[model samples]
Target: MSLVDLIARADERGLAASGLACLDRCVPLLGGDDEVLRPLWSSLADGGADGDAWGERLAKARAELDCADPSADTVPGFGPDPAPGSGSGAETETEAETEAAVSDEDRAAALARRMLATAPGDPGASALRAWADACSAAALQIHRLLDVAADGDGPLVAAERRRQVAVLELLAGRGAGGLRPALEVSTEGRRVLRAVVSRRARGRS
Candidate 1:
């Protein structure tokens, strides 16, 4: 199935794999200004966007899909273009052409870390900053958790660690909002880690 198809397969099924597939498709589709991915891409919740509230975020992403700027409040969803009811291969091709406009990314990850490309480090980068803070704390907590739980080799601990790493990756490359429940590598794993991080961060400050 196409990457989009994989994403829409079923929210509870293959969420991580679907996200990876979507990313794979994005490699060739990003960087340009087509604005086609605006609806689908924005809907993803990198990591910080908790699962409970993700649907609202997805809606905003889809609504603002036409906006090209990431900070502009648009994050696209992976929903079928022309909306499941377009009724024609030709329309799909047209949508493809429309999405094809954005072909190259000029961001830090895609480029050579030239600038703070994902989002500015300034306070205005609210989404990026919130997620960043969440992820950073999550990472440290998860690491400590792993070290303490190393001898246990418990599947639960392993699963939690995996989730933390995935969240970190999502924040690092795609910002905190790209990690949709649909894109989650470990489902609720990162969330548990996020709580641990919150307590630790509170203790520190």
Candidate 2:
């Protein structure tokens, strides 16, 4: 089944896992350690029924990611746009413009951070559905931005799409049992993203 079809029919647990897996794979962009979101995943494995546990772990993950403020729309230092300012001269204006422009990397990271920030505390059916859909889009966009190939749909994007579809398929077929393999898929993607982030940093240096 298509990802959209799968998501539309996913149960509450499947939806939560789908969204959390997307964010987990993009953790490198948020500067999160490998285990920062482990609690949240464990909560899911515990059946994801305790909304309180999910909320607590979600808050902790956000804190670990330095996104403690839920109201903040953009990640600090990675804003989608430049801060407004007046330049006194043409040269100053040009410099300001350069500083104000957001890089693809920054925008990608911002989207990842937003995914974390917007995760629902309640994990209801409606909320999880919206967050899952949004995360899928954001994760795909992040991969597209970081993909170095001239083609918009490069290997990174293609792999991400496959992983996403694999995740939903796993959940659809195996129910809660699928969380483990789904996480394995996400872990592979996380490693890929970490490598991409490292390579980009090295290139910049």
Candidate 3:
């Protein structure tokens, strides 16, 4: 099926993983290694997996992927190794090549790509994005809420604020639909949005 068809179908029937899978097929077909793969992987790695679910999938991808060197995995088009004396300080990171570790951004990107490869249009695609986005937003929100509460906003005000947010979220969600269906397909990036919707729905502080 065409990409537009896949996207429209995903939006209708909620098949993010499947949609992503379709995109993966298109990537190579369209020769979008750097443009498509990089962003896709960025989103996936940043998102996450379902414990063993993620690991098993990665294993399969590893088997299929062909890297020039097995020791270190490199982003397809990123700049090469640092200059000989690139180390400013007398020390450097791990004795092993820096390539061993995958940065959060890189991992997210890789995961996104993998999702594209495995389950393109599945709602989990949004879920992955939500999860990644939530970490930071939740952290900040928690800190702010705590500080605000400590200042003695009292449960009444806090409660009302939550209610307001909830109403707003519900209205917004209603404009679309319920939060449950939205969260169901979560992966990493979209999990945070789900929580906010949840908080608004449930009137949580």
Candidate 4:
């Protein structure tokens, strides 16, 4: 089945797993450890995205990601409020321009956080559909932001889309046994992302 069809037919657990797997694979872009999202995956076991386990593990994941370098210029879900008595003229303008130059890592981190935060509490058909849609968009955007191509579509994005579909289809066909295979697919994507990061760093140097 196509990715859309698989998503449309998938049960709540399948939908949640599909989205989470995508984000988990891209965690390297956020400078997150591979194991950081492990607890959230555990929550998906035993038919349980509905319980507090998912929420609790999500909170922990967010916390772990957040604790990295507060002064770093990463994007949060909401932009920080302008500080009281903060300068409003040339200084503000300069700061605004500086902030506009968000790093690729920061942008990827924002997308990952969006996937985590927007996951459906109920994991019902409607909620899961919405969440899955958001994840698809976010995943695509993350790949786009990381793409180094000077002109049009790059190999990175093409591979990411293929990996996304493969993951969903794996779940649809193999059910729970597919998780490992799905993760293996994600691992391949993660390697591609890592190569992209390396290439960008080398260019910068």
Q: Which predicted model would earn the best lDDT? A: 2
Q: Count the backbone clashes (under 3 Å) in each candidate.
A: 25, 0, 51, 0
lDDT of 3 by residue, 35-92 (tens): 3333333333344333344444444443444321223433422335557897654334
Provide TM-scores for the models: 0.22, 0.87, 0.22, 0.76
Query: What is candidate 4's lDDT per residue for 60-174, written digit by digit as tens?
Result: 7867876433223345423676787886778777777776776766777687766766666556667877787778778877888887665455767777788888888877787
* Number of the top TM-score candidate: 2
Lowest summed lDDT across 10 adjacent residues in model 2 is found at: 74-83
Worst 10 residues of 4 by lDDT: 68-77
Score residue 99 of candidate 3 by CA lDDT.
44
TM-score of 3: 0.22
**Model 2 / residue 176 / CA error / Å:** 0.8
Q: What TM-score does model 4 achieve against the real structure?
A: 0.76
How far off is model 1, as Cα RMSD? 18.2
**Residue pairs with backbone atoms closer than 3 Å in model 2 (clashes):** none
True-vs-predicted CA distance for residue 107, candidate 1, Å: 39
lDDT of 1 by residue, 74-156 (tens): 22221244556747888787666755653222221122111112222222234433433333333333334333355554554
Check candidate 4 and list the clashing pairs: none
Query: Runs in model 1 with CA error above 4 Å?
Result: 1-123, 126-131, 138-158, 170-178, 181-183, 190-205
How does model 1 fare in lDDT? 0.35
